[model samples]
Target: MGLVLGDAWLWAAVEWSPPAVAEFYIGGGFDTPTVVALLVAALVKAALLWLILRAPAPGPLDRRAKALRRLLYLAVAYALVLRYPIALLPDAVDAAFQLALWTAIDVLYLLVIRWRSRMLRAAAGAVFAVELAAMADVLLDELDLPELGSGYIVELALMLGGVAATLITLVGQRRDGRWSRGTQTAGWLSVGVYALVFPLDVFGRMSGGDMTVPVMMDALGYVGTVWIAATARELPAEGRPADLPPARRRVIRVAVTAVAVLPIIALIHPEATPHLTYTGWSMDCYDRPSFGDLKPAERDAAFLCRARSTEGGVPPMFPDSLSDQEILAYGRALCRAKDRDEQRALLTRAGSASARSADQWDLVYVCPEIVGAAHPELLWSTTEAEAANAAYIAEKNAKCRDPWPRTKGVVQATANYFLFVDGDPGYLVHDPEDEAADEAAEQAMGKVYDDSTRVGVTDSAVLIGHVADVADVCLTVKAFRTPPPQRTAGWDQVNEVPIVSRSGQLTVPEMGEGGEVGAGAPMPNLAIAGKGRYRLRVYVRVDDAEEEQHLVVVFPGASRKRLKLKPRPVAGRALSFNSPSSGGRRAVARGAGGRSQAELWS
Candidate 1:
């Protein structure tokens, strides 16, 4: 009784069962059917064991009987302790430790079993010792010994030993004259089943294969336990009655068979259906408003017909009055009628134009007849407003398209020019008075610009500049209309500007101490022949660093006015004049010194 209780508790704690179906019997939290079943089964078995324990003793307790009773108590205690606390250890350690403890308990139980001969006990002991060694290897991660090669050899040896033990035990049981033929045959059969199942189970686990074999072994083990408990008791002396009555024995056998079959049934049962809330198309057609007037059977038939047809299959049963094609057509028409009626009902409840929702507008757009009768002007006005808004956006986008050529360094007449310098705090302009001031200004400028530059476009100009440290600089020039706000509204609002043309890499050498480098010529032949302000933006990059600057040139509608050459800092880089300009064209030079030298000539 103690052994049975302990085994039951151990199995429950570990949840030893088939992988795919184990959840149906042992998983799910409290309140689930499977968990409830397990609790009921456990309580019933516990109650039965309690009744058995309460029964009168058969005879005086011998040393072997006392030892067996103590061992049972010990097994129960060990199981309870491990199940609660010790099982919390790391998986490998917990499994290995549990196996070792169980192995010890099994050896003790075997010693108390009162085997017919010493030879049989010895064989069993040898098999258990081999099993214990294999378990130890598992505990140590297959011994981690190079010569062992994954511990398969040790497992195979243990399997062979188990085979030998099973054969010897069967032969010994057959030869014994103390027990009845029925008992010996049952013992041999149980041993044979175990011998076959155990190896297959071991191999399945080692190879990580399918669990069907292990599940079978578990079922067989349950039956074997019942058989061992029923037949392994000592026989009464000559002319004595059996320990249990014939009727009781038959009842026990029937009960044990039922108990063993329950788990197998649970293991093989189909998985529970997942609970899902029905929504949208999955909602039953019978629940729709259209089905309110129909009879229950008619409603069911309609839903079934629609469901089957929706799945692209013929309905099993159709209306007696309708053909197959007519049934399908009728089902589809009913569904569409219900949808249209429901949509109209919703629009009606939403009231006239003042209270209409987005869904009502959508319905009106698709089926104008539904709401257009009451709110014709509202629908017409909405349609015109949407068309106008779309047209406005399209016109703005058309005006913002790329307005420059694709070629590098090929400046067009309408193209604006920009310049920028790349460094940390960006472009620095210093006006040093003396050599000492120049050195001081150079240090200050170095601290300011460090390793960065500035680049971008303004109202009507493109200013492209580069710092001296930069080895290679690429400038991409893009044009945007500056006046007539509606024409450039889209480009003005967006963060990403459109690229019109690229200047490739304007490769420049490292600046010599006394020499000046021309950044680039002014964008020549600009065709700014419109009333609007035109701007050119230059995207400058020194190596991998980015800088942006812009230059704006306004065309006052063909008026020839002498525009002053005001050196303004555009996008943080100072525009400086190196020499005097007599003609209208401004000749700009980027110098190494800290200051710009400008001479104005008329």
Candidate 2:
């Protein structure tokens, strides 16, 4: 007993560690303590039943008679309560069904043991067959064939055959007074083994594998149950002790049978993480809407834009700005700026030219770096005043029992467009009164655009802007890469910066420091051919520290004339970018200036 208990202890210790046990307890209905208690109870019950069956036969309690009684007891437990519970839980519900499956398989083993009469054996086999079929069905489903859901005829045949065989045997052995001691023990032991293996299946599910442990356990349980039944009902083997009570023998048989199941259960959890698991983004978000219940398009758009804005720039993978050669010229000038003042002046001149060009040609453009800052307004959101107003509107919905929590701070600024207002201060009108008062409020606080108009469609709470066709005009922006007010210096210590598109793919060619790196110097300008979309994906690395990447997409048809957004500082160690509208010929054409080719212009 000590050795047996030690084996159980040692194995369980390694198999069910604290973390694994806790996860099991939380994920399943039963905790470790309760499961242990149940396991102990099962052994005790089996032992007691075995003891009863093996007790000395009073008067007419012959071997055959005792077997009949055992068979009757096991049969009753099956038809009504035992068998059905296995099917009670829904398929998607993992834990409860798993428990039921193991319990049912164990029951089959027990039935096979207590019934020695050929008829009773057949009856038990029938029940086992039904369960076996079900197990097969489960396996086939795991294999993932489209037809598996419909039902497998082979499984059905096995189940029906077992049922028929059992019925015939029961009729022929109607009066058999013997139960198979071997089957009874085998069945009980099989269950104990199943108890150990059950958690492994659950763990597999957690690690994203199909739960097929039950089927495997059932297969082994079947053989053990049959063997136990055969041993229990064995005819006095020539020199065997005929005086031994049937019940006692049944207990001994079951105890030994349980040993057969131990190794299999112990081996269940060792399989490594499956080759594939449906976890990560697919399980969490892609399969269903995780955040707000937005549509696929809306979510995709929001996600792409938010990602770009977060990095403070649009993706540069697609060159929507001046071509590589032209950008190289600008880059050369930018890198040559010796002092902070010089850097700012050089960047400002380039930025102004880009901005004016964007404005004049209606071409979307972005200064790779303005004042040594790329996309300084990415973090900007609705102001507190506007947030308060949105809250007020939300309260109105709350009062009406149609609460729609105001998702304030939902506004995001795009590269070519700015978010002017999401929920601006005084955005919602709570009161309507005299004509004069209403007129004043409307005149003073009327929104310039609504949701639709904000995106350049209809009036809305959000607004975006883009350059118009032929909006080419040179405008300068200042840069302060170095510390405060200093004299302008030409590029000297700057290094070439490469931009990337939204896909993390590099777009522009390496640009060197052109002599153009001067404050108030005109940046190489380019024009958009038509109402095409574009994004400026720029990578800026100053003084060889870290590279800062920005991706911006400009939807000419979407933006308004101008957007009002607070300039916010970029707050990350490494800045990256992505924009959806930065692909294809929508980008700026190279070589617009007379002297320099597009590739060599920058």
Candidate 3:
């Protein structure tokens, strides 16, 4: 029975992941290979047990043999019962059922052995009781009553009980006339092997270390079981061994003791054993191809091919067979080419169409850098290259100006501004400055600028000029109370002044050209209370314009004065004004108002 149980554990450790015992009867997932393998193994074991039972008794059968026969019968019955029903149960229920089944088998064994010897019976009964209690404890643990700590306590008791039972069985076999010397030796050896290996196997499993120790122990245990079974069959009914020579007896005892101590020493100092080294690739290198074994020419060709396969325009290939000097010369010439087209032509002429072979993308990208390291003169300065490339791109964009509508009045306003209308869709005011051009281009392409045009006021007359066309223009001249200038150090620093109140849009005709549009008089209700400098702002929207005209009206006691407007590019947006501080002040006020208010101010 001990040998049979030991074999079961040994097979479990050797043949299964998470051990076969868990997968066989308890683990869910019936379609798994593990469950099928276990079922097949159980069937094979049952067939073997039947064959063993049918085999003729070697001489007249003893009490031990009869007990073994009964145990074998129970084992076969248990295997058949567990094979189908246990597999069908839920995982938790299956685990509990397996535990109960094993405990019942142990109890039955205890009952069978009781008639043999009183001391053995008591020990086996105690072991059985302890095992049953341990099963109950496990079931309770699964229920999560952790305060009980029944798992640990019951496990310890179960181990002690097993040890006691083993000792009592050994004593009974020795004293009773049912075992031979060979059988006794085999039985003790089996026990000794189990004692040495089982704990180490358990520890290895718990600690999650290498399975080598447990596997070695399991093999040793199987050998011991085989030895015990063979010796038991050959032994006589009156199972006492023939007397052995003193020297041979001492040698056998010494060998057994040495075998038992070795596993203990190994468990205590595992590092003393030689370990197998893993040579698998690291995480970073796993995806990359190893070119260490490839020829230099082949490696280079592979790199070139890889670069071509990646998304993006394929770069012209370089020859794999080029010498370092030749490679350096080629790289220098490629870098110094007048343009990208010239570089592409030079690379195309030097490369062979048939020689393309893909390698790592990174290697291909850095191929020039790799060869250039040998001759620093051949390596292009990255900073210089980047600056030149940027200048070239800017020049190209500057030359590729958008074709504006040819209108009689539309002329390049100064060198930086131009105004034109494309049919009646809208008027366009473009600033020749690169930043402004880019913004105008984006607005032109998108064609949705309802909130783009706006108006605002400064200390002078209302400045208005972001109109795309004057056709859709509307001027709202409002009188706003200007906040008191912030005082710093007892003197007003005039840091900021904000609009406090306003009237509705003044009745003024749509603006057309530069003329006396609003009687050229100070618009009524445009004056604020107190000695504050009041200004009237005219709001206008040219068709599809991203900017609004902000005309500032200045009143000098009932008379309106118009200031000369000079449109200048300020931070990519064109603001038509002559005052140097107007842009900065307007920006500060707009920023203070936050985004929505800033949009309104604009």
Candidate 4:
């Protein structure tokens, strides 16, 4: 049974990210709110252990009674070791001693508890130890520490205690010649409970839900096993005090434990918003991805504000062509070429590493962005080669811009927009002589680019835009409205919606279809207004197949508007216009030099 419960915890840790357990896996050293929670839990657990120890013990023990006592002590001690492995260890030899200790405990549990299967206990211990060790390794990597940090000693002690208790229970069952009803029930129920509880715990963690739920479940299982075993198991007559009812005492113990742990579990799980804020994009993230792994669609939400908007049954403008990966690669390439150091810094800030592939999008994009600044020679040579390439692309698709830097300083913004491609995204340094040289270069570029005005920094280069002004720039998601055949008079858009910032820095803007945009939602037809440089995110849960444009209309003084896309559905109706430009609508395919770049990575 002891082995079974241990296995339960092991399975939970590996198969699913149990909340408290996940920290250990993610290089537990990256101190976050969750880490703090673990520390607090350790303290609370200690208090509980102290209280349990002080509780009055039932009198003289029969063999079974003796076993139960040992089991209780072992479990409590093991729990402590898990939290503070070095509490009883010497400083220098702590790590080595801890590993040895846990290993010894495994042996003790398997050997001592004759009734409980040895193999099962060993299996559980092996799994648990491996996971803990893995987590410790991650933590060490995060800290750049050469060795696993302290805590193993404590874990070993705790394991030892749990083993002792399991052994005691088996002895009692054997001495009685047959298992008591409660003992038998606990053993069976434990197996089933172990299987179920850990899975639930893992699922909850992966889903990024409240951690409290699973921890509570564990406590409940533990207490339940104890309660069941105490009540149904025949008590050894020698250990019983005639005056006290063992059943009642056991119930009290269970109740007290449950009550004590309730608050502890609550403390372990708190409302956490795992959103990371960075330049250009606001992201709600949990585990940060490796830098290069971020897909283009994810980057799009931050860079271009390409979230789908729904109104009047209008289908959102999804880049029917681009895959998320392609988009991100393109974006990275563009950023990197134009602004190498800064782009590298961005990836680093986002918890990503530098690029290994020169053919990567970051490299490609940077090639053009810094043609004059960093790659002047390449710019001159590539320009001619690019022109030939452009001519070929232009033949295939008029919408495609063959010469990437189509116009001097102009880069195709997407199939939908244009940016000056010739101009460097920011200034770059040629080879720096030393650290001091690098700093000097950065400072010089900072001044040239007006770092104070720029929205972000690219290594030594400034983005050459104000973060606030950048945030205020209106990046519209254009939707062509195709009204329904039957337009109703009362048919007005349910105006309230949000232009969420993916970076998670600013509070979500209030937007709506009509009237004043209230808190939380915005009113449509209004310009998306705000003060900071921010990417807009629009999501339409509604199924409207109408063409509707979501616009981020910036008002002076940092106020912004979220124009709700209220397109009237066109049911199989073909409406032709002389020109898209005639009605002030931007032509998506106006310029023909190369194939139109697809924004959505389909």
Candidate 5:
């Protein structure tokens, strides 16, 4: 009876998410709190075992069953004691205490009297060793060592222990004869539980499913095998406790455990398809393509094809082998060209890169923005691009300009993203003078990310993570003729990077309704219309409990002839992402970030 009750208690813990667990199981009174159920069950188990001292041994069978039950109860004791304690002791001392607890459990099983099976004892040792390693992870943590495989250690150990126990039970059933059919069946059922659980723990996570799924599966299996063994009354025992109980009693125990565990899992876990939370253009061709793999023309095409909003969901035509240098030269010449027709003719010249790809919308939209002071080359640009640019500047001047050097505005923090204010998304995709881009990418993702890591930064973009998931942020953008002697008051973090613009037009591109499937439209882009390097210093303040503020300041930079810039690797959703619960309202903080909602890549 005590063992049967333990099964129900284990089920209660399955609703582990806490006060959120349903007040009533189904049509009412399943209202047991998880901790209360576990504590009561632990006491009941201890009480039943201690009562053995007052009476003669029931039989060898019952004594062996009691021995097994004692080891199982320690799981609860471990939680009540060590697991719940806020370890105030030194690292080595805490480690030693846990080691001691596992050692005592192992000793108890080793002294199993009459019906001991060698394999079952071996399984106990396996459990002890695994648990010690899992628990000792905190020691390495305290020493400030890198957490090598710490996240999955406990789950892996549990799976391995289940494998050990399952095998031993099956082997013991045959070797220790005197087992009834029901007892034999219980051994096989344990094996089935392991088979179902191990794969979900491994594969489910790789596929990006919620982690809780596998844990819940393991819980169901745990409660199940215990229920089966409890009802069959079959284990290596002095009285051949492998003997089965009456059919009616067996039915009652089976019914009790099933009723306790299955209902809660069914009621609590939502049935939903897996939603992959990746950042990329909805129509993007691939992620972080290797520049070295493509020829010059293909590489240029690849760059143009990357996350940029084009009309009708169509990607821009290849750059037609047009390099940024060639385009910049064309813009410089157009500076001397006389009228709109001459400017149009200059771009439309036969066999030129511009003429060869004159019909592409991105090139058209970007052409005017790049050649900032040139003729109104509406022939190579679109009305929409012209209109967006005009409105953007007007809004900027109204809010940011009147304030003189600093312009304060509310940046739309949509879908947890902001800006990639580069003149070109494909900047330095093919430069050979330096390998900084590749090295920077390797460094950004070279190690596992920790909980505090809210963002990823590469030469391509600055991944601003909403650590607190703030939707809209108040910020100021200022253009400086030179860097300030020191950071202004009120900012908490600071960094300066060189911005390279091919067209001299820097833009803040944002995602629209299409999400990762489509390269998003642009917000107002800054027309820094000269092909030169510039310094951008960003100051971020996140200490505000309600809002995040960023100060972006840009200034001219001297040219460096050491090496050509390497395009940095982007990480995460380079385009954009929306959490399932996001209301679809867009508010992005895209100052140092890049075009499209996709922020970065691996």
Candidate 6:
């Protein structure tokens, strides 16, 4: 009972270890809450069992009971090693540690077996010896092992140990005339557990339906350990002589059969046998707001279906009902419907016929009309969605269509730089109260031609400068492997700026419609390598827009505007310098000696 209670406590710690234990217990150096809890509980059980052992009770300790109690302590130790800690070990050492640990526990188990007669004890010992021999490679230090190979050997040894023990018990029972189906021993029952649990564990873990595999496995193992101890405890002194009642014997056989069948049924239909299970968490689809309650088989089918349906998108999972299938098929059907009335008809028919929930949620975008009052958020009118979508695209087109017009060298332009593609002095006329969205759009645009020459360039057009009043301004670009020495002393202004590229291409786009945001189309294609620093030299004779020859010297360096050549104003940024009132040209502020404030000439 102490052993079982101890297991219960440890199992609680295991179940709660993740969030609960991790949330609270962060003191010990080990940092493993489950391990600490398990070890502590196991130790407590050991102490309690030891106290029980030492307590002088009656004549002699019932030898079989004493053996079983000692075995319970061994089982407690086994339980300690049974979970979480072993998994935390490095796989290289995990195998070796597992072998050593289990070997020690098995050795302890061997020392604890107290059979009725000398021959029984000797037979058990001999069977154990053979089992140990079969697993000799585990203790043998020279055996080279793969990663987890030793662990596999340990598992095989355990299974083989069970097989050997069961066989020996059966042979001995047969020889001693103790063989009786009605009162089959624990060893006979253990074979079923060993056989069934391995497959169940494998399938359950791989089932994908089971979210609580680790917790459930630990729990089932704990139960199995308790059952083993219980069976061990039932061994009688003087072996329950031939005077044992037939009714009691028959009851044992029935109990054994029932016990063996119950667990298998529980694994297959855990929802039906919820009492038998440890963890209640699973994809049972029972209480979820799907449609209605699922029968046990339907629930099981849906759970496994969802689990195994690991395809591209969420696969259609439903109980075996054509009505459910029809509801699932409605997603595609509504999309093909001619109009809202037709869609409503299709949805109503399906909804009336089946109680299954819509399988694909994202399909709401396709079939929005089906999103009735139940899901009010999705109850958006088609016109509203289209309007919103059109608004979204128009906004994208307005903001992302072209790069901001910017000027390079000093002397601000009187005309030519169109601040917006739509020729709006402010911005998209559609956005009145939503200037914040426009501002967000501009910030996302990533390039700004502010009052400062030392500017943060974006992947917008590499450079947009203002060369005023050009009949046909000749713009030629020269790329440099290394920066050529600057000769802009005589030049009007030299603006050294950094060129930024995200698409890996930079270019001087002709004054036209650039494509959408990041995918800006350059002159037909693109070039000037990648993002790097550039130095632009502007030469002007003060009135040179007629045949302005602008030579942009591109190089990899840093950005530093020619300071003091143009002093920047604190405020009064023009919405568009290319004002419609200015005969489709930009107006600039002129300062001392008729010199313009700020501009990008190219």
- Which candidate ranks first by TM-score, i.e. highest? 6
All candidates' lDDT scores? 0.36, 0.31, 0.39, 0.34, 0.40, 0.39
Per-residue accuracy of model 2 over 1-602 as CA lDDT, tens digit each: 31244434322332222333334333434334444544554454444345334433234444554564455435433422354554455543433343355445335344433354666666665555565555555654544533223434654564454434344333322234343434434445544555555455555555453323432443344433343334334423233324348788876766665565655664544334222222222222233222223443443333322212213232321122333334334444544455546644654554432221111111112222332243222211225323443343334223221011231111111111110111111111111222243333343233323421112111111112211111111111111111122111321111111111122121111122221111112122111222222222111121233211121221113223332221222333222222123221111121111111121211
Q: List model 3 lDDT by residue over 1-602, tens digit each.
A: 31255434534533433344533533333333433444455454444344333332356655755555445444444443444565666655755775765565565445433246676677667766765665566666666655223355555676566445445555655655455554466556666776776567645754553434544453454434333343334434543346668888888788678777866775563543322111121122223332333455555433333323323334334433443334445555654566656756765666734233322122432354544444332233335434443443334234322211132111111011111111122222222222333333344424423223222222221223343322122222333343221112211011121221222222221112221121112223333353334333222222235323222222213223422122222334443312122222222111111121112112
TM-score of each: 0.28, 0.21, 0.30, 0.28, 0.29, 0.33
Better of 2 and 5 by lDDT: 5
Question: How would you order the candidates by lDDT, starting with the best?
Answer: 5, 6, 3, 1, 4, 2
> Which RMSD values do the candidates have, in order?
24.5, 26.4, 23.8, 25.1, 22.5, 18.1
lDDT at residue 140 of model 4 (Cα atoms): 55
The better-scoring model by lDDT among 1 and 5 is: 5
Ranked by lDDT, the better of candidates 2 and 6 is 6
Better of 5 and 6 by lDDT: 5
CA RMSD (A), model 4: 25.1
Model 3 residue 168 CA deviation (Å) reads 2.3
* Best-matching candidate per lDDT: 5
Clashes of 2: 107
Q: Flag regions of model 5 displaced more than 4 Å.
A: 1-20, 23-57, 60-69, 74-107, 110-128, 131-158, 169-181, 197-237, 242-602
Error (Å) of candidate 6 at residue 4 is 22
* Whole-structure CA lDDT of model 5: 0.40
Once superposed on the true structure, which residue ranges of model 3 sit more than 4 Å away at CA?
A: 1-68, 73-120, 139-154, 197-211, 221-255, 267-602
lDDT of 4 by residue, 1-602 (tens): 31244433432432223445554544423234433334344444444434344443344445544555455455445443443555455443444444444455444434434335565556555554554464455445545677443466755544344334444445445544434443433444444444455445544654564444444353445533353334223333334323336886587457445554544453343334222122122233212222233454444443322212222344322232333344445555544444456554444443342332122222322234443354332333234534543443334233323221322211112121121121212212111222343443345344544422222222211122211101011212211122112222222221112222222122212212111111111212222232223222221111133222211211112223333343332344342211122311111111111111111100
